[model samples]
Target: MATLIGREIHLASRPTGWPTPDNFSLVEAPVPAVGPGQVLVRNRFLSVDPYMRGRMNDVKSYVPPFRVGEAMEGGAVGEVVDPGDSALSRGDLVLHQSGWREYAVLDAERTSALPPVPGLSPSVYLGALGMPGLTAYVGLLDIAGMQPGDQVFVSSAAGAVGSLAGQIARLRGASRVIGSAGTAAKVAYVRDLGFDAAFDYHDGPVSQALAQAAPDGIDVYFDNVGGDHLAAAISRLRRNGRAALCGAIAGYNAETPVPGPANLALVITKRLTLRGFIITDHRDRMPDFIKEMSGWLREGNVRFNETYVDGIEHAVDAFLGVFQGTNTGKMIVRLD
Candidate 1:
């Protein structure tokens, strides 16, 4: 019956290099009432991912840059508080792209109702069962053309997308799954998660580490961190190897142009296929991905981790933590 006051994190300024806390501001505002054909949602969780760093920059990319003084947006799961559409009811759980805020008012069509997954948390939709999951699914199977018994290598393997990508490869019958991470603990974690081999990139050069991990050469490379990792994968790929060009978090904060992989010539010499994709472009794959991934999660064939930072006020730190390698898995903010 009373107006709801909500808090949100806004992009205060674009960062020149690495983002700082000053780049974001948390402010309180009134939560708008649900209008005809609209729904009001109180967000319970917000996602902070490496891709967001690119969105903060004023550059032309697959997605538009975030506008200064506007609330940052990403994946979020919430409960509907006010429903103006006949299809949705109050108390229904939904997923939408109106995060970085405690409450959102949007057209009902923008929100997708989340069906209850027995024995799984609803917040999982913001991680393994959500965009990150879909990214891994489409990137590996469709883009990279993964085949059974292929040797697959994934960079940033302990993180959200890479973690799932490796497991998916294994579950789909990869003969060997190798992962590269930033720290020893992360390497161990991925190994326990079923990677046949895991290594800390900080311990040595990526090329050398990868070569040692996969002596015969890899058939599929799921690249998350570009730069040197790309070069390493290129050098070690067997003939006709395929690479799913995912995120390049290594260059996300670069003020200067980063160099292309010198060994890219291998793409031609080895006849490799390197392709980049935007997950939204493959929306038609969601039903299949959900069906398969849900089964995996239910059967414990796939596992995921999430680092939760409490409160909307700390959303900036959560976002920055992704680049700092502080989170071993998906970094999320608990806004409730």
Candidate 2:
């Protein structure tokens, strides 16, 4: 087979605050050779997630910062084009962490072979059926210890993890699921996805909105947006309420440091259990998640939405779109 020229989006410069299109650059290079125990794959879809924004900053965090002038990486689903190992055959569908590119040559061990799900889009593996799904599952089930009959609230409820987290709570028998989003459309979308009450956070003070949405008080809070949302959840949490802290997108691009929720003191008064989690640290739940989430998708108990923009060249726009709230659910770049 002829060697392929691959294009990838690279971090041109680290942003001091909010990112712009100038922070990224597209470069062309030859696809690397398939080494021993390695495979060459052509990516079909690339995921643009909110967490990746943190990777762009030069900070000490859970994941290393993206190196300037180097290719940015995230989740991707692709087809193996050249097999150098028996584990992954040619044309096999695989999920890996080499996104922002059109082709990748990596160790076979680094890729997970995915089985096709009937009537489901393969790209869902990057969203609801993949990391985001697992993040929601572990955060709500393990971290928060959500129980049936709980009154649940989720922030950023129209985005990838938040969207699924709210639905998962309802599926697990939460008495009420309330969600907050940036726009009326997103608020409506989350309600359509089974949130018992959904409101536009921009409509008014988060605390007032949340209280109006869940007058009985929230038993569990799935936090995807920090800042005021966290404060709101804290004020409304029932005694001994549990909160699963996930992404803090509200402050991800803040130029100046943002203050913690002013109502943080309520945590002590309400006897709340607030825990933050990195989804990568909880791999033990993948099996259970796959089984349950797959069944949910198949039975139509769970649903996922993805916004697709074609071509690797549009990757930066897709990534920026996450921060802009341009996507209702997962934001993906489909390579042609």
Candidate 3:
């Protein structure tokens, strides 16, 4: 087995809201020889998520905060270049959690062997068929309890999780799918994704825009950008409407407090249910999601998109780009 050197990303400084280059550092380290029940991976793909922004702050969250000078953790997909465990073999593609790095050595128990996909890219295993896909599925179906003819709204509709949520809602018989995006390009991008309608949140009031799209009121809101988008959805939700709070990409880098508006009272008055959830909590449903998403992919019923940056060296910039709304879909880093 060959010894592969690993390069890891470290948290340099904490950002007030959205992150900048000052927030991250890159370090290279020696890769150790694997022992029994261990696998050395030459990572090919890694994920950059908005949720990581919350984790970067030294504050309380559902997940632990990132420690300074330590590796910033994220999901990665790579081939088993050297195998030391019986569960994995050389050249097998696997999904594991490492950081922004060229290679990683992980305990076999912490990794899973990914199934082969014919005529599909391995990088997507970190995207549509990966975390974002499962996040969309569980948040909408399991958490939101979606049903046919339900009107669904997704904030950051052009983003990694939001984009998929809208399509999944459509596939599951949503009467209408409305999305909110940051840019005109992203707005059009969501519409092209086959959403019933999409609006640019930059166009004045987000809630007012949502009201225009779903005049009858929304049955469910798959929230990605929190704050105003959330308040707006609450203002227009049907009685006892359900909301799946995913991420708050809107205020990730802000140094100031994000203020809530007058519409929040609607949550109590309308009896609207707004709940925040992390994808990790729903891992138990992964096998079923994989089975269903795979079928939809093969049948051409559902599609997923990704923005890739080549090489782990570019991972830091690629990761920071997501906060600037530079990516059109899920942002990933490719090592090969």
Candidate 4:
């Protein structure tokens, strides 16, 4: 049997507050040969995300947290190095749940072989054209019932999910689309992506900013960073306004939890509806999301940005950058 070699990182320890470089440990291993019904992948890219912070805690969650010393789990884009099943062949561009590694042996049924598009990068399967894209689509269309002419506001507007949410809102003919970002640069970035009004949440009170930007009130809130952002959005939502609680990054790294009254009383006063969902929670919507995103991408209407780190050794810093808003788009690590 042919022996293969690879580099890997495992969950060395869980973070108490913000994750540090020490929380992960790089390790090396000989890659296993592909077994029957499996395919070995040589990973090209891996994803680092804020949600992973939550997963590091051993507490109960929608998904289980990683165990200490275990390989940290996440999405990856790669190529098939050796095929052991008829479903996938060697040299296939693939996406898999391969984690923080340079190579992996996965069952053929567990990974997807990507269809080739001349200019599109395979990494898009991990970002705007992938889970983030699908999350925005499902949250807006199916969850929030974003009708044409509805005004939509998205938080964390320059990140992977928020960037696309703004563009989609515009494409849906929202009367006014607003977005909030952590810094002036990110605000400007979102505006460049076609937000009707964009604001740096750092500038002033978000509620006041919403008043100045919208004058009226927002109809839908695609919330990414929660805590004060959600509280502010609640104060400015119109009667019967809807909210898709997509993420709560504002509280992700806190040593103390950010309490969320978010004026729950307003639910009765405004007759509002709030829904929280994970992307994988709606797998049934994948076909529609892929069709729509592909069409917009082909039409050049929806654009995407990426911030890539060159290697897995810097993966910790890449992952930590999300909290400091160091990344302008999806933060990814090239593992080659």
Q: What are the per-residue Cα lDDT tens digits for candidate 3 across 5-107? A: 5778889888775677778877877777777888888888888887788888899988889899888888888888778855788898888777577777888
Using alpha carbons, what is the TM-score of model 1?
Answer: 0.97
Which regions of candidate 4 fall more than 4 Å away from where they truly are?
Answer: none
TM agreement with the true structure for every prediction: 0.97, 0.98, 0.94, 0.97
Candidate 2, residues 1-336, lDDT tens digits: the string is: 687899999999998788999999999988887889889999999999999999999997999999999999999999988888658788889999999999998787767679999997789899989999999999999999999999999998999999999999999999999999999999889989989999998889999999999999999999998899998899999999999999789899999889998887788888988899999999889999999999999999998989999999899988898888999999999997
Per residue, candidate 4 scores C-alpha lDDT tens digits across 1-336 of 657768888889989888888899988889887678888888898988888888899988988898899788898898888887647778998877776888988888767779865467788889977888998998888889999999999998999999999899899889999998988889889999999999998898888898888888999999998888888889888999999999998888889867886588998999999999988889888998888899898888988988998898888888889888999889989866
Q: Please give the lDDT score at residue 311 for candidate 1.
A: 94
Q: Candidate 2: give the clashing pairs.
A: none
| Residue-level error in angstroms, candidate 1, position 162 | 0.5
lDDT of 4 at 90: 82
- Sequence-dependent TM-score of model 2: 0.98
lDDT, candidate 1, at 325: 92
Tens-place lDDT digits, model 1, residues 90-113: 889998889999999978876668
Report each candidate's C-alpha RMSD, comma-separated, in the order given: 1.2, 1.1, 1.8, 1.3
**lDDT measured at residue 109 in model 1 versus the true structure, 0 to 100:** 74
